[model samples]
Target: MGTPELALQVEPARWLGAPAPGGLALPPARAGRGTLYAPRGVYLDDRVVVVADSGNHRVLLWYGWPKADHQPADVVLGHTEFEAEGPGLLHLPTAVALVEGRLLVADAWHHRILVWDDLPEGSGQPPDRVIGQPDLRSTVPNAGGSPGPAGFYWPYGFTYVHGWFYVADTGNRRVLGWRGVPEGLRPADLVLGQPDAYSGAENRGRGVGADTFRWPHALVGDEMTLYVADAGNHRVLGFTPPPEQDRPADLVLGQEDFDRDFELPHVPQGPQRLRFPYGVALCRDYLAVADTANNRVLLFPGPPRRGVYLPAAHVIGQANFAESGENRWRAVGWDTLCWPYGVWGYQDLLAVADSGNNRVMIWRLRRS
Candidate 1:
């Protein structure tokens, strides 16, 4: 199919990045500059919590799940300044996950992970424990002079599955696993992707094939398997707990091979491919891929195939937004999407991080 022409109209519902006082903003719907690069994941709530990593170098917290509704996360994490810092300070946080009763943050650029134990606190004030970059720093400005597990290099997404914590080390171009640190501090238990780098200047990006990754942005995992949003490579890599104890992705999804294409990377299949897939989530038997480049969400029925890419069992985006890549992905309802960078399913709500468009869209996800 060729690129679809966009028919939907673009409208501004609200403004963000306003000088919110007391972490609150209402009335006069403040306008955001523009969602050009709002890299964020979803919060576990009926409310759509966004890590609008505004240009301010701070995560802009907004809450409003059903769209028509309006409310914002009463809390904010990171420094009030437009610069990244240590401890409570965050820099370009791309992913946020709720682990146990606390919040887990992948403070990208700062090269570290922060655990906020103060549940429901207005903002992530002083995390109970800070991992990566013992000095506590963001991804940018590596001037902190820290080491790898010693510090993170652009950790993008975060997820706590089964009994472990996973981080998408974007700069390093790999995923790091750690035993879920309930107390004290957990160390990196395993490293996925090019675990070995020749030097500090090289990104560890190696795998069986295309699924190895280019710039890993987000990830999702359950009890037994791990799924990766190999953003730069435009594919999803899957793997089981390694028997060799090395995090080698055993399966693949999206395209047929690593060669860049608007399609998902995998081996050439009878028919199937993805384009710039950014976020991923598994709902029941369905594995959802936010094909970011195409501005659509493609759903696979049987999950990842080690070799071939599967045609979408369902799709949302221009297909639902008038068949145009103009506005990215948008699910005004279920089974629809656009330029969506994040997707998550829990309970009956499916939360999507509609990155470029500046809003997280929610939909009812059901099994047939």
Candidate 2:
């Protein structure tokens, strides 16, 4: 049989930020206006939309689902005023999610994660807690490069799964886990890609391997499975029942094997490979990967089994799996994407953080 293809519903039905596509600019961060720049992370549900407005050093929260284009946000974090990008502010906020009524943000460049316990009552409120550093004012990696259990350098993204908090500590080239929300400089409950918690080595100090990682950027999974976007390695690694310690992934995507780090030679470059796959979302039988550098999203009608190089069943943002050019050699539009970094799927809605274009595109999946 031939590869499956998905039919999206009538182009992108809605966008959350920026009226038009534009490059990075430092303007007064405003809601429902053309102010977002290089937005890298986004999460939404039936009631709320949260964006890691990275370029502005802040996070924007829209309490209700946006009914129209460019809807104003209900809350903002990291600045007392929209124009300020000062100390104690979010430095390159790259991830955002709600955990137990609290808002968590991966403040990437600051080398820490910030948490708002009660989801900020209004714009510019301070965070209730901090992780990876002694306090909110400190931006040091592992607190002056000490490299211990709590030190993190460039933590890009995270996910809460099976009652554990997992962080893709990108700079450290590992993923850290905690049984609960971390408070201050505490040791992680589990560590992956390093010999021990104190060691920060690229690919676990052994170079490339199925069990090692280089720039593991994003994570999403559940109790039965785990997926990590190992960006630098140019593959997505999957683990069954979630590994508790350093172990090899059972499934590998975008490469011929887990030991292979380079993209396979496909004359037209197809769905069986990936180029800097940055974001992933899986719900039930559905899976979506933001093949970032290739400028498209790959969709699988069902999750691939362990130890198999199953090709993606469908392609989004491009006409087919064979073409990998930015925006499929077309202008940036609702039907096209450029360097999308984060994606989330729930029910029938799929949201993509189209980073290069600085917008969030929402699509309704159609099975036919």
Candidate 3:
């Protein structure tokens, strides 16, 4: 469930997969909350799914929702505070995905990546393929130095894009890549910030500010563009296809035009601005921003029909939800939403990683 232990360090995400109107039995009032803090990113397909329960020091696999919470997760990928097992376990599992028929985990705290072929089969807990630390050490781990394919440091976010894997190595201040992924999980081919950073101070050595990202947190890529929640930059940076060396971001949001500072906060006209944006995704053409600090999910409408060109339209929760301050949880029309950190597009429904309030919130998105 959503525990204060994890919250203080990682901010847990709520399981928003809803129960049938009058069907599934509700768990004990206390058991339904969430077990994440800064529960950052999520991914799903068919009957299998994964979550980066970051602060919790684990990754949870479900046989899909509705059936998810009720059943014990099909897999537990790390060493939880209370549970003991696995490949010495994970320090902070920030993101997860099933890639090329294999499981992928951004074992953030351990400074590496872990892979599994089955949900909870072989080894029961030990990862078959690991990328970060070679041995096991619990307290504040280190990557030694330059991550040579099998290494990473505070790799905060991850996703499988076009058979390749892209990682936001937060502590290292870079977006490291495993071109052809699952196949090339070693040695990053592309690096955004610096590489395999070992010290906190050195993280920003590359440069801080809008132009050069500091802590590039989460990522989401579409057919034509790649969107990054460039946390330190205080803006979302985008790049058109044909991404190349130092390929510039095509657009910026949260703050006014790039390179220029926003007179106010990043959340346009809202109660709180985004202090840290942890996750992002493209639902059709709409862009979803999990404005974590502000405790809200922001949406920018997708492009119009081929001929129509209505550019730059934004939408938060319900219009009635006040756009100011920290009361987003109690906003008139909101009814729900708390420290929401990550999001993914699911057909008509949007699966949200509602980190703080302790539950995933799925809303049926609509355009009018």
Candidate number with greatest lDDT: 2
TM-scores of the models, in the order given? 0.73, 0.91, 0.74
Model 1: lDDT equals 0.55
lDDT of each: 0.55, 0.78, 0.55
For 329-357, candidate 3 gives per-residue lDDT tens digits of 34312234556677777554566765554
Q: Which segments of model 2 are wrong by more than 4 Å?
A: 1-11, 21-32, 83-88, 264-267
- Evaluated at residue 334, the lDDT of candidate 3 is 28
What's the alpha carbon RMSD for model 1? 7.4
Can you write out model 2's per-residue Cα lDDT over 1-368, one digit (the tens) per residue?
12444443424777776665333332233433345667889888777888887767778888867888766667778776655554348888987888888888999998999988876778888888898888888997777875678879999989888888889999888999888778888889889878888777888777787888898999988777788999999888888878777778888888888777886443576767888888988743667888898888887555764875678877778877777776666566667787899888777778888877767888777655
lDDT of 1 by residue, 1-368 (tens): 21223221222233322221221121122223222234456655544354545233445455444233334444555654323433346656667766776667666656666677745444445666776654443334222543344346777776777887777767766676777653323446666665443122223432335325577788887766778888776577777642224545665666665444344323322224566777888765667778776666666655554444546655655443224353422223322333578777665555666655445565555432
> Cα-based RMSD of the predictions, in order?
7.4, 3.1, 8.3
